[model samples]
Target: MADTGDNSKTELVQELNGLLADHFALYTKAKNFHWHITGPRFRDLHLLFDEQAIEIRDQIDVIGERVRKNNMTTLTSIGSVAKHTQVKDQDSATLAPDDMVKELRDDNANMVARLKGMKELAEKAGDNATDGLLDDWTDMAEERVWFLSSFLK
Candidate 1:
């Protein structure tokens, strides 16, 4: 594979594309939960879901751009994303608030797992840029874990 400036970034680019697909699916489901969640903590869950969805949505574009920067084609069509994403679509619009919280928390944990794996790959490729980015992404995702866990208990 050709070097992307310094590193042969094929693996990193592929990981980033996978991240984009996963996060995009998660983001949409976050919004779906935001719109449909109902329970005693309706206000709290609604706001939290909306904020997370926005954060994931913003990062989706950046992840796609990173793929392009690394000389790889990004997933654009919904079909492509569906094929690539590890995250599953929400099965119901009328989920109880607890179920919504549990589902999103699990998804965010999965995202963190991928981010950590990417960090290792980035380090191996000597792609300092990707490694640094993954650090922030991982930490932020870990915090989401904390918040969600707190909500669950």
Candidate 2:
């Protein structure tokens, strides 16, 4: 791993940290909806949210380590996660199941967009590893968006 230039390295770290924060936010929201969802479709949605949450959670550490591999500090606290995340938090446990699915779908869509941005940044930085990892992350988020959209249809 040769140098990526200091400025490019910093930008990549910032983007990666922001992505990491968004993933954490989305993971928590998915778990919340999984636990609070109620309706005739409870079993299907419950399982869906759990599976999505697990996938998001699994990649979180990988994102954090990517930042560390660039010799930068990743988000340290819940406060940092809240500050850096573009994903909005959902506090209502009483939201309709359909609405929950809609929100998650939109959030995952946003994540896909964000991952694309990060991929571009990685490419500009000449960081092939991060760029490749972003592809996997984008696919995961897109899959979640697809699954959540099924509920809307």
Candidate 3:
């Protein structure tokens, strides 16, 4: 890959790390909801949450590696993840099942927006690999949002 110049590379790295942090935060939120979900829809909601959590978890390493592939360090700790993440944490486990679905739906929609932002940065930097990966990730987040939205209706 050709160098996209230092400034472009640095900006791409920052955006990518922000994305990685969001993946971590959202993944943890999904798992937390999975574990705490209860009520008549417990089985369905639990499974859905777990599946979404796994999808997000699977992307974490890929996103982090993209940062490394760009010759930069990725996020190193929970504090750093918190610092960079735009996704808000759902620390209280008391949310109703419908609320859980709503929160996750909204968060996944936010992920799509974040992914699109990263894709634009990647494209501007001429980072084809990152740009392509972000497209797939954006698709995944959109699908998750679709599935979660169905539960709300």
Candidate 4:
């Protein structure tokens, strides 16, 4: 049997790790778009992507702090994040502005799904703090997806 304290902490750590991985992956993808996007939408997309990347980075710190609060180590390496994240890195070099928007929309949707799953896990584990954190992330991701999808319509 697992000790109660450690078990709860472990659960929180696992959820946090997954959240952190998603955040990092999103960050990379956003930066990729920011650096590679071109065409008529270049100016707007470049600034938007930069803003979005910053938002993801902010969430990363929040997730890392949550892990630390749970008395667990945070995963900080690219390899570790890649291994844990469900988000896929894209080949940005070949993508057009519309493609970039579509990719980000898909990524935001993926993140929303992941955060919802994490929220359920947090609730089951009685981790309100984590649930609250995920709630914020879910809202932001949904908003981002909406904005990105609008560009393609």
What's the TM-score of every candidate structure?
0.92, 0.97, 0.97, 0.91
Question: Which residue segments of model 1 deviate by more than 4 Å?
Answer: 1-8
Model 3 clash count equals 0
Give per-residue CA lDDT, model 4, range 1-153, as digits (tens): 122554655765786798799889989999999999889889999999999999889888888988887667989688999988878889658698998888889989988887887766676667788888788889999999988987888
lDDT measured at residue 28 in model 3 versus the true structure, 0 to 100: 96
Candidate 4 residue pairs in backbone clash: none
Clashing pairs in 1: none
Number of clashing pairs per prediction, in order: 0, 0, 0, 0
Model 3 segments more than 4 A misplaced: none
Q: How far off is residue 109 in model 3, in Å?
A: 0.5
lDDT of 3: 0.92
Per-model C-alpha RMSD: 2.3, 0.9, 1.0, 2.5
Q: What is the alpha-carbon lDDT of model 2 when measured against the actual structure?
A: 0.91
Report the C-alpha lDDT of model 2 over 30-49, residue by residue, as the tens digit.
99999999989999999999
* Candidate closest to the true structure, highest lDDT: 3
TM-score of 2: 0.97
Worst 10 residues of 3 by lDDT: 1-10
Candidate 1, residues 3-29, lDDT tens digits: the string is 646544877888888898998899889
lDDT of 3 by residue, 1-153 (tens): 467655777888899999999999999999999999989999999999999999999999999999998889999999999999999989988999999999999999988988887876887788999988988999999999999999988
Name the candidate, 1 or 3, with the larger lDDT value.
3
Model 4 earns a TM-score of 0.91
